[model samples]
Target: MEPTRLNKYLVDAGVCSRREADRLMEEGRITVDGRRAVLGQKVTGNEKIFVDRKPVKKPESIERVYIAYHKPVGIICTSDPKAKDNIIEAVNYPDGRIFHIGRLDVASSGLILLTNDGDIVNAILRAEGQHEKEYIVKVDKDITDEMVTSLRNGVHIGDDRPTLPAKIMKMGARMFSITIVEGRNRQIRRMCEAVGLNVESLKRIRVMGIKLDDIPPGKWRFLTEQETSALKAALV
Candidate 1:
């Protein structure tokens, strides 16, 4: 095999993303041929590579898997096996290792994407992609025009910058649907708090062009060919 960057190799081996691989290297958990690996190191795929003392296979051609899951509330969006409510254990995918594309807070439930192809992770999560994620949220109080206008305009949510303009539609007295391009930590909830409302429930309904549809909470399904193609195309 041709020489490849260590981080890329780890990603192709399904150990983790390039960013996570870098973290492992920094923590002195990655080694090559009994020597600690360094960031940006390259290998020809012929050397023994180990991550945290476990041997990693050379990058090989493998079938890629994409799945859409209706993540249930309380399931943590982390791949760490030690985490009590990790999403990976909840899915119990029998095929091979996979990681979530983005995160949904433990208090929220909804559509989340998972895949074995590490190459697409950054593409989907990059802010430059401006991929839209839609959610149905219920606040503790009645919806107000001022709140809707503020959300549609933009609201400061304790971030370095205010959130980008969002698409808002009041669904009922206390229920509304919102669409946002940026995914920040507890963003929707923080936005509500910034506007003097408390989020009672938040559920993502769509990610890009993929929808949760009828997938039962805690259950998952493979992405259709059409959905996969459209998603990749949007990343471009």
Candidate 2:
């Protein structure tokens, strides 16, 4: 194998993110061939590596891990510079860098998908005209039967195209559920507001065939082998 950037090698091997690996190097925690390596160094497969005096393994040899986090309402789905208390901080995955498959807003939460497999992220997020997300929303006031019918058929929520026909289930006088294939920013909240309902709470309980079930708020678990395949299949 050819050489690669030191940080990329370390991140791919599950040691840390590329940025965190850079910190480890700056702190004199990484070495190449028994000599302390500096920032931005590249390492070939032929070189020996150490981190904190222990050998560093090759990146391609590591297995990836995926997780399902039942994110709480306050967390955002991101790994950007401003992502304090976001999904990345919430799970604190100790191995390879895992990122959310799509995103959930800061005020809406449940079943956020995390994966180190970058391909899966693209598969789930960018697949045009494929897959769907389902959310259960509670509002502060009752919705008239007429309003429910309006949302089901379509409403002008400042979008050029009418929303795809949604599956709306009336749960109570002030509660209902909607399933949508294409996601837009604050799509659910805006959809409700368009018909004069104030969204009091929003929780995504299902994505395709996966359900949030008993997963607690603010914690995460690995996707079962079956779940991984099912999730990928759903995107098709």
Q: TM-score winner among the candidates?
A: 1
TM-score of each: 0.92, 0.76
- lDDT (Cα, 0-100) at 200 in candidate 2: 89
Number of clashing pairs per prediction, in order: 0, 0
lDDT of 2 at 141: 86
**Worst ten-residue run, lDDT, model 1?**
122-131
Q: Give lDDT tens digits, candidate 2, residues 183-221.
A: 888888888989998898999988777788899998777
Task: List model 1 lDDT by residue over 69-174, tens digit each.
Answer: 9999999998766689999889999966778988999999999999877778867756442888999999999888999999999999997899999999999999
Which stretches of model 1 miss by more than 4 angstroms?
A: 52-55, 127-129
What's the TM for model 2?
A: 0.76
Over 4 Å off, model 2 = 1-59
Task: Quote the positional error of residue 52 for candidate 1 in Å.
Answer: 5.2
Clashing pairs in 1: none
